[model samples]
Target: MPTSSTGSNPGYVPRAAVRRRRPAQPTRARTDLARLATRLTERDVWLTEMLHEHKVLTSHHITALAFTGHRTANRRLRELYFMGVVDSFRPLRTAGSAPEHYTLGKAGAELLAARAGVDLPATGWRKDACARIAFSPTLEHTLGINALLVRLAANDHLPLWLSERSATRLWGDWIHPDAYAHHGAAESDQLLPFFLEYDTGSYNLARLEAKLPGYAALAATTGTRTPLLIHTATARREAALRRRLAEPADRLDLPLATGNAQLADPAADSWLPLDSTGPATGRLTLSQLSTHWTNVTPALTPDTTMPTTGRPTTLPWRPIPPRPPADRT
Candidate 1:
């Protein structure tokens, strides 16, 4: 957890794109693939409808709808455009723009034609009625987070916390991770004891700072130590993040763990992988965290949780909802 001093500062440090499995270029779905592609996976269709209804879209607007993250939303938008579902209409004046604008098109209407029946909760943790938040991402090739969750739950694999976003109360629509730990053949609890926030660099510093109080409050009330677990991917900020978290972290008496240090028992730390395999040895050892830190504060200061205000109706997300039971007439 960071102090108020970090919140008062504001400076920008650019970063290179973190490499990831680029979702296949959104292609024209036809024939077999058309049969495969039914409707826009929850959020994509909803966002297409929402943008069309709202008129235009900005990067910030995407954040409000809560479609994973900026990167995910951006990728989906590209897909929508490629599929002729929507149009980006980037101004011809410059190839790059800070906040690109978006508009709806014919394909977008088609995407939304049957969207009325799409029953994702209209208001979520932050009043974000994003459809994408509902369905789990399907993997065509390798093992994915949801697939891992299912495997762990089914005793096929151990537990792992590869969660991105969760909306818990006593805080707000904040970045709380979901815990999926498996102990032998036992079914994994849908939610883990709790997990920590990995942080570093200026961006992470600001987010971790503002988030500390919320997390602290959550722990105090729930009697759960969802400690702030920051992984310093860089060799630079590790020292500072450790120093900053050492004392205030003690205030909460939470089970704090870092990439370099394990908080006594990593299993007790709340992020145990479902199958008891743990990230490394019954613990979270993602080498893929922390690339930024020493971040000033402005980026993280907004104690606000979501694009919208108020509570989000919690619907099961980690696992897609079961198919509805058939009606017997």
Candidate 2:
């Protein structure tokens, strides 16, 4: 593993990363007649759009979000991968089987652009770019964050999900969180807007700590606070992070909490607040987090007092099976 200046091990890049290459094959794995008859399903297009937006997603993430089961999702994904509409890779896992990670393939990008009446460049789809992302050191972190969002979507607890690409449009080149989201709508008008930091405990603690000033500056500019949720690999890492967070600093009044990888569910009541002086309270869910730490502020936009709820005017992709019927007799 290579180490960056920050002393954190670069994300795991396996030998397969450099060896994998795009085959000079046609875009359709099925016969021309079958392809013509079926064309592209709505779900197929939706999957591509998701990959484009999120950069990378595991097969399980896609299944939980789009299909009824792993078998169905896996079958479709394999077809798509062979058709050149999606690219996939399985990294080296230390333990059990590793899930296949998927990215937008060349044909998929073209399909998205055609559907949207936009050009290829506008779609930002490049075979090389997809390969680069697949091999990037931060690939694991990216997939981990997507997994969190997928779990939320599975429970219909995710009302809005803004990929880093969409978030960059608001914050520009500065202060890009892993993801910007609002915990699914609640009974109260409370729209919880926050940023997720899916730390792998790879980088130097000091380098990670250095990012605090940027968040503080972002808050100062927007005139509102944004809660940052961190999910780390271990309790020891979380403690070290909390200690660094405790250091005195001006205008850094942001609510912070830490969770670990061993957590069965990231959105469950598993986070420990940094500023809590009392003995450790139980874990807090995403919805409960906002209220649990009153000091944590909702994200804001610089131009207006509007909350950064991350809700798009139109949902980019529709969730499947729609929420179950309202108790129909």
Tens-digit per-residue lDDT, 15-120, candidate 1: 1111122347545432132532474565555455444433344443444334436676577667766665655432222222323345554455444433333223
Judge candidate 2 against the unseen true structure and give its global Cα lDDT, from 0 to 1.
0.65
Cα lDDT for residue 62, candidate 1: 49
Clashes of each: 25, 3
- Lowest-lDDT window of 10 residues in candidate 1? 1-10
What TM-score would every model get versus the actual structure? Answer: 0.36, 0.76
Reference-based lDDT, each prediction:
0.36, 0.65
RMSD of each: 14.7, 6.9
Clashes of 2: 3
Candidate 2 structure quality by residue, lDDT tens digits, 96-170: 335677888777876766656566677676658766875677666677677767777767776667787666666
